[model samples]
Structures are given as structure tokens and as C-alpha cells.
Target: MVTGTLDRKQERIIAGIPPVSDFSGIYFYTINNKSNHELVMLLDSIIGLNDSVLSDWLNITPRTYRNYKQNTDVVLKGNVKEHIVLLLSLYKHGVEVFGNTADFEHWLTEKNRLLDNEAPYSFLTTVSGIKFIDNRLTALEYGENV
Candidate 1:
């Protein structure tokens, strides 16, 4: 089973989805209630990723990100929404493992031998890559050396 330190609301948000073993299942939980402003806040507040990285992950331009932040009514769709859910889920696991946001963010950007000297953040752009990172994080949680 997928384990983490997520609160009841976060757990409820992801309850419909399958466990993290099927990492792609995370995309099935759409962000229906949240506006763009909420998502942006979550990204900044939880994951601590910057605007440039978020823009790249969402496949949106920097200007669009600013516009979304400026317009509270704007809602995200398509890849942007999917990426946000994925990141939020990952952030939960990361916090559970690392114990704090700063440590998780550092681990994300730091090169790891298990990942062939690549930072975990490099995998955030694609579904398959996110799955691989999730698998690695699961392994780490279970005391697997790699």
C-alpha cells in the first residue's frame, strides 16, 4: 500500500486513485475544485519549486504562469493540471520520507547515485519518469539500498 504523512483531506483527495505502485493512476484524480491560484500556491508552498521550473513542467510559458497567478478565476487544464496532481502526490511522499519541505526539495535537486547521478527533479516532466522516481522513493522508504 502507499504510505505517507498526508492529512485526511489530502488522503481523501487521492482516495479514488489506485496506490502509488501504479503511479500513472495519480493522473485520474483531477483538480476539479481548485482554481489556478490555489494550484500555484500549492506548488510554491508545498513543493517549493520556482516559477520557471513549474512553467517547464506544466508546458506553459512564463507569461502564462504570471497571468494565471494574477487571475484568480483561471483554472488549469490538460497537462498543467495533470502535472500539478502528480507533483502534489510526490510532494506528500517526499515530505513523509524527508521529514520537511527543505530536505525534500534539496533531495530532489541533488544528484543521487541510485538515479545514475541524476537529480530526482529531472524526472518530473514525464509520466514514465515520475513513475520511476516514485518507485525509487518507495524503495528508499522500504530500506532498499538502491
Candidate 2:
């Protein structure tokens, strides 16, 4: 449901992805695909996050990520893979709710009154935090005050 324009590569990467609400589907994808650095970088680019932020979110050092990127055979741990899947799903949902990637990125970087003046980007490191952000987006979409 991404309303924002995506490049052909991004579209192909996201093609056939299920909605975020489909936890089981995402879980299956994560388990079966066993994420590599290439996929992580693709999702990070689509979400407009830099390598530093993505490394922090994944709890991996930048050097480690670079090494992984260089070694195509290297697959991330299951937890990291799951987290990446959740992040991409959240990014898609955010774009759909905000009508475009730029607006969603702005919302993510800005401090929110509902979050006690914390930017939404601060919460991307954890799955529960991502869900909280998702709930906030849903509230806005439904015209409910959070």
C-alpha cells in the first residue's frame, strides 16, 4: 500500500510482500530467506535510513556490516532477520498512512507530542517500539487522537 513512488529496484524488492499485520507470513519469509546484507541494504535504502542507523538498529557494528556485505555467504542471525522484516513492513505501512515516503520520513524524524517529545526514529531499534509507532500511525489514519 505504498503511495510513494519507488524505483524499479525497490518495487521489485518489495513485490509480493504481505501486509505488516500478517506476522506469520513475515515470520515465514524471514525463516526461509535467511537475510543477507544485500537485502538489509535494500530495505534500509527504501526506508531512507543510512548504514550507521541500520547498524545501530541491528545491534551490529558498521565494520561487521561491511564485512557481511563483502561476504555474500554471510547470513544474519534469525533475530536480526526478523527485525529487518518488521522494519520493512513498518516502512511500507508508514508510507501508506502518510501518503508518501517524504512525509513519512519527516514524521519519523520529528519529535512527537504523543511520544513525550521523542522522534519516532528513536523507537526503530525494537520490535515493540515499531509496533507502538504503527499503532500511532493507525490512530492518525483513523482520525483518533493518541
Candidate 3:
């Protein structure tokens, strides 16, 4: 992690954002690595599904997929199912994976990018949440082609 007050010289992204917290790199890349054409496209292209697809899928026109790109907490509010689906779809196809919010936020801070995702103001990561999503959740149920 960068230190000493944002010197603003070496402005480069430090790491891959798993595209999510639920799945680790192993699981995330495994799904996307398959020979699935749709999955491949999702990986190479930065934001896979645009706002329209998410809104259409979740039946919410006012919302945006860009909003969904950050922490899962806020996105889940409008429709937990949709938020989770987007994440699973991304993880299953995306090449990288972030372990948790700390890792994601660290990247944002280092890159000096706008941190806009609406994570709950007081959200805290927990062991159970990680375990549940990683080991217990059914991948296919959430659009993970794995």
C-alpha cells in the first residue's frame, strides 16, 4: 500500500479488483476461464453488463450498473438478487478478484479514483459472510456458469 500523503507521482493502479468480494481469485477466474463465449466477452470488456441490461433484468430503470460496480452492500438494497447476480456473473467471468472491501478501497485510494459505490456507511466485513458466499452459496443459482 502507498504511504505518506498521496504524493501524486506514481499514479498507477496497484492491483486487480476481483470484481467482487464473494469469490476468491481461484473461484472467480475458474468460471471465466471456461470456453464460454459470453463469459469471455464479459472478462475482456471492463464493465460487462451495462445499465440497461441490469435495469431490464432487475426491473429497475432508475438504477445504474455503474452504481453496482463498487461495494455490494448498497447495490443490494435496490434488489439484492440483482446485485448478487451481477457480482456472481462478474466473478465467474472476470479475470481478477478482490478478497474484501479493504482491498478494493485500497486500490481506489492508490489510483486516486473517485470512490462512488454506495457501501453501507458502517458496513464491516465478517468471517461468516465470506465463508457463506464462498463455500455454501450455489454458483449456478446466481448465474455463475461454473
- For all candidates in order, the CA lDDT equals 0.68, 0.76, 0.34
* Number of the candidate with higher TM-score, 1 or 2: 2
Residue-wise C-alpha lDDT for candidate 1, range 1-146, written one tens digit per residue:
12354455545554443444554465455534454566565565555667888777667887888787777787777667767767677766776777777887788899989789899888888866766777778888999864
**Residue-wise C-alpha lDDT for candidate 2, range 1-146, written one tens digit per residue:** 55345667667656656556677898787777644665666665676667787778777887876676678677788888777777888888888888888899899999988889999989988878877888888888899864
Rank order (by TM-score, best first): 2, 1, 3
TM-score of each: 0.77, 0.84, 0.23
Tell me which residue pairs clash in candidate 1.
Answer: none
Which candidate would rank higher by TM-score, 1 or 3?
A: 1
lDDT comparing candidate 3 with the true structure: 0.34
Instruction: Point out the higher-scoring one by lDDT: 2 or 3.
Output: 2
> Which scores better on lDDT, 1 or 3?
1
- Give candidate 3's error at residue 96 in angstroms: 11
RMSD list, candidates in order = 4.2, 2.4, 17.4
Runs in model 3 lying further than 4 Å from the true structure: 1-46, 64-75, 78-146
